[model samples]
Target: MARSGNEQVSYRRAPNFLTANEPEKRLDIRLSYKSFRALEEQALTLYGISPVEYSATDSRVTIYTAPTALHGYSAVNLQQAISFAVYNILVQHQKQELFERIVAVGESTYSSVNDQGRRSTKTPDAGLSYYYDGGTVLTIIMEVGASEGYTHLNADILLWMNEFHCRTAILFYNKECPKFKFPGNADTYSINDRPALEHTWFGTLDTAVLEVFKRDQNTDTCKMVVQGGSLDIGLTIGDVLPPNEDAIQDIRGERVHLRINFVRNMLASGSHDTAVSRFNHFIGED
Candidate 1:
């Protein structure tokens, strides 16, 4: 239980909520930063739920329950694929200094908000950060909206870019699982609801899009430079570099691509095609 000024709120273990595979849980209390951390601790130490995420914003808190086993497999494998590619590029260029500082912080909690409710806090689904000058900056973020909408995903990237002040954010809006049923815990998406689009280059593009939000240091703004079903583009060194350091050791212009084909293979569990197909069936079940 936590105290919020005049009101008292309790954090109970809603096992049914987790069993439902729900995405997020909202709290009306405007928890202080200390209270928020306290809630995270109790949820972890007392409840044995360590891999959860919490978001406190707009005088409320949203606790992101751990996803399904399938989601866990895909999210970890996908993040590993991207981070490995990036780290490999740094190794090739022998950027040992910057490379060491650059690390993949998967689902780590960090905040831009304070005790006074001046800002917000988040536990990124998967993210990357760099520590320098006694300060940690969220560099690259990856958010998988398994059950979220376009507007939420769209706003998330900017929050990462402007609020947490990250360099880039890769938003993967899951158009696969389009519906959410509460008490029953069933997903319903008619096959005719949102038909897939056939792209000339990618053969067929699933509604599930891959977008990259790059922030411009000069203007403190961001843009969706890469958006598609199958992303074949690479992240320029500028995209992954630490803040305020554009050119690094004569290797200013470098690009590292997270090959979608490679990611597809990585996400495919032990059984190869069968595993991949089964995974998709679970996500797109009507």
Candidate 2:
């Protein structure tokens, strides 16, 4: 799976069903643990990184980097870490059903038409897609990293909302100063009789905490607790749940509850030893 920047790597051999040349055609392919591991290794080699744990789908692959990696804190790693932490918390709280319904997929491609009726596809950093009635609905699409500017992020989010009809889109960054709104709901509104869409801003990692915790202090505990807020953005999973649960509703028509905490150190950058040591402590490693 070696690839140069200009090279197009083919996945023709990637389980026949997963290979689709048509934009509208969809395929479902399952991989065994060994097959998935092989794919991950191939992706890592393609990225020229050391062998590390990773995840992949039919279209995209993600290599999980440690907080102490020489590259420093990565938004990709942060996105996966936070998603998994939320997933685990849901499971621990006996909300397995909600957990099953809410799937956090990384780098998955989504296809839709833009406002101009042009077909387009985008691979969001992470997506919390919900399953209902034998189909999938993207509840939230998340963007990470500082490489992308706010304008670009917003344009992409607008596409996801206008084209894919996603309920919410969030951008997560570290390093950049916070300059976005807190958790708020936006609906399609008319301005000068022209339709305008609104998207929620979860802000930078620090701002996200401030919105949820209302404090600026750091603690050695290294875990940040997130709770739901009353905003039109979506439904509240529960009082102690993540604030972005406005669109999530259980099969029983009840508002699902969620609660999660993530290692703060993993989202911050510093010396490799300090980052790794903090990560180890958070995970209870000796």
Candidate with best lDDT: 1
Clashes of each: 0, 7
Task: Estimate, for each residue in 1-286, the C-alpha lDDT of model 1 and write its tens digit.
Answer: 1122222233344433333334333222333345555655554444344434421211121233224333455556657766676677777877656766677788676657655777556666777777677876667787765444566656667767776777787766543322322212113423343322221101121345556677774323322233343344445666766747643635655655666566556434422332333224333422
Per-residue alpha-carbon lDDT of model 2 for 1-286, expressed as tens digits?
0111111232334423222222111111123224445654665555454564321221232222222231133434544554555465566556656566667667677776657886666667665666656776666666543422344445555656566666555554343233222112112222232211132221233433211111111211112333453112122233223334443333222322223223344444432333334233222211
Query: What shift in Å separates residue 191 of candidate 1 from its native position after superposition?
Result: 28
The ten-residue window of minimal lDDT in model 2 covers: 211-220
lDDT for position 275 in model 2: 34
Indicate the worst ten consecutive residues by lDDT in candidate 1: 196-205
RMSD of each: 11.6, 19.3
Candidate with the greatest TM-score versus the true structure: 1
Residue pairs of candidate 1 with colliding backbone atoms: none
- Summed over model 1, clashes come to 0
The residue pairs in collision within model 2 are: 185-233, 234-246, 235-245, 235-246, 235-247, 237-257, 241-258
